[model samples]
Target chain A: EPEVTQTPSHQVTQMGQEVILRCVPISNHLYFYWYRQILGQKVEFLVSFYNNEISEKSEIFDDQFSVERPDGSNFTLKIRSTKLEDSAMYFCASTSYRAGNSPLHFGNGTRLTVT
Target chain B: LAKTTQPISMDSYEGQEVNITCSHNNIATNDYITWYQQFPSQGPRFIIQGYKTKVTNEVASLFIPADRKSSTLSLPRVSLSDTAVYYCLVGDDNTNAGKSTFGDGTTLTVKP
Candidate 1:
């Protein structure tokens, strides 16, 4: 089975610094999503991207955050200025069909630590 | 999206069958129930999904009654490795928004 892959399993950055998380979703998937889970908290949806544009985003995905599918294979999430509260495990997921109809394939996740 | 309510935690011994039930009293006609399992420090993995009746996969089985007000995830002969947090989600197929609201999942502790 194909799997989504995330780069830099763990990342550490200073507060107010810019950080980018990269992901490569399954080749055949058409929909992609980003979620974050703070320590001991429920997974929170950040944004969903399709057809090279954002379909939807949550309140947490504010002006400081952006997503780009730079190429056919790489999906990237950029935080303009990292905050201490931004520390969490960021997950990238994709599916061939819409989320409710098809199961999402997720990467191991990238743990971001903001100091 | 329909809200789901499930247990916070459960415990079972190795080699035992375990069932985690979730309640969604206000499920919509177009909603489908889905389950995902998450191991510590890892992303959540899909377990099974069902609209009605019983749906079985290699990993688990999902049983949804005619009313669709509730569902159960049955894992046969669970082992220590089966320990993980299981999430139940209800969503409609027509929604373009890809967000699936994940509530606090039921943590299953498989004891040896």
Candidate 2:
């Protein structure tokens, strides 16, 4: 079975630095999403992408955060200036629309650590 | 999106059956109840989904009442490896916005 793939299983970056998390969604998936979970907190939605454009975003996805599908297969989330609170497990997910039902398939996740 | 209420945690023994119920009193006509499981350091995985009645898959079974206000996830013959956090989400198939809310899930610990 195909699976979503995220690069840099773990990352350590300094505060105020820019970080880009990369993900490769399933080949046939049409919708993609980025979600984050702070340590000991519930997973939070960051953004959703479809047709190479952002479909929805949450308050956490503020000015510093951006998502892009630079290539057909690669989806990325970039943070211009990281804050200490930005440290969390970032997950990439994708899904297919079949019979008007779609279930999210998530990658292992990228653990972002800001110091 | 409909809010869901479920137990915070549960403890079960290996080889026992585990049933976790989630209450969504405000479920809408377009809403579908879906469940996801997450282990530490990993993203949530799709388990089973159901709109109404009982839906069964290889891993678990989902039971929804005629009122559709609540649902249950039943895991049969659980093992230690079945320990994880399970989330119950209520959302619409048209918008897919319901998935955005990942409330605190019910943590299940299966001990030997």
Candidate 3:
């Protein structure tokens, strides 16, 4: 089966610095999403993108966060001025159909550590 | 989206059949129940999905009653490798916009 791949499997940065997490979703998928999981915590949805625009975002997705599909296959999440709280495992997911109709394919995840 | 309630943890031995149940009292008519399994440091993997009745796949089985108020995920002859956290999510087909909320999942610990 095709898989979603993420670059920089582990990222370490000082607080207040900027970080960009990159993901390559499965080919032929129309919907893309980003989620984060703090250690020992539930996975939290941050944002969803479709048609090259944001479809929905959670309150956790603040102005400090932005997502871009700079190319047809590359989806990136940029966090401006990362805080210590931003340290978590970031996961990228993609699905061929809308939520509830199809299952999402997720990348292993990028572990981001903000000091 | 509907909120789901599932156990925080469960324990079973190898070769046992494990069933994890989730409750969704406010499930909407258009909502579907989906389950995902996550190993440590890895992303959650889709296990099964169902609206009503029973849906069985190679990995597991999902049972939804007529009311759709609750669902059960059954894994048969579980092994030590089956230990993981299982998440249950409820979402509607009409307006989710590809966003799904995950609550703290049920952690399954399989012993030898």
Evaluated with TM-score, which candidate comes out highest? 1
Angstrom error at residue B51, model 2: 0.8
Model 1, span A1-115: residue lDDT tens:
8999998899999999999999999999999999999999999999999999999999999999999999999999999999999999999999898757677888999999999
Candidate 2: pairs in clash? none
- DockQ metric for all predictions: 0.66, 0.52, 0.68
Interface RMSD values, listed in order for every candidate: 1.6, 2.8, 1.5
Q: What is the TM-score of chain B in candidate 3?
A: 0.97
Residue runs of model 1 more than 4 Å from their true location after superposition: none
Q: Candidate 3: where is the Cα deviation over 4 Å?
A: none
- Taking all chains together, each candidate's TM-score versus the true structure is 0.98, 0.97, 0.97
What is the lDDT, from 0 to 100, of the residue B55 in candidate 1? 99
Ranked by lDDT, top first = 1, 3, 2
The local lDDT score (0 to 100) that residue A38 gets in candidate 3 is 95
Winner of 1 and 3 under lDDT: 1
Clash count list over all predictions: 0, 0, 0
Model 3 steric clash pairs: none
By summed lDDT, the worst window of 10 consecutive residues in model 2 chain B runs over B93-102
Worst 10 residues of 3 chain A by lDDT: A96-105
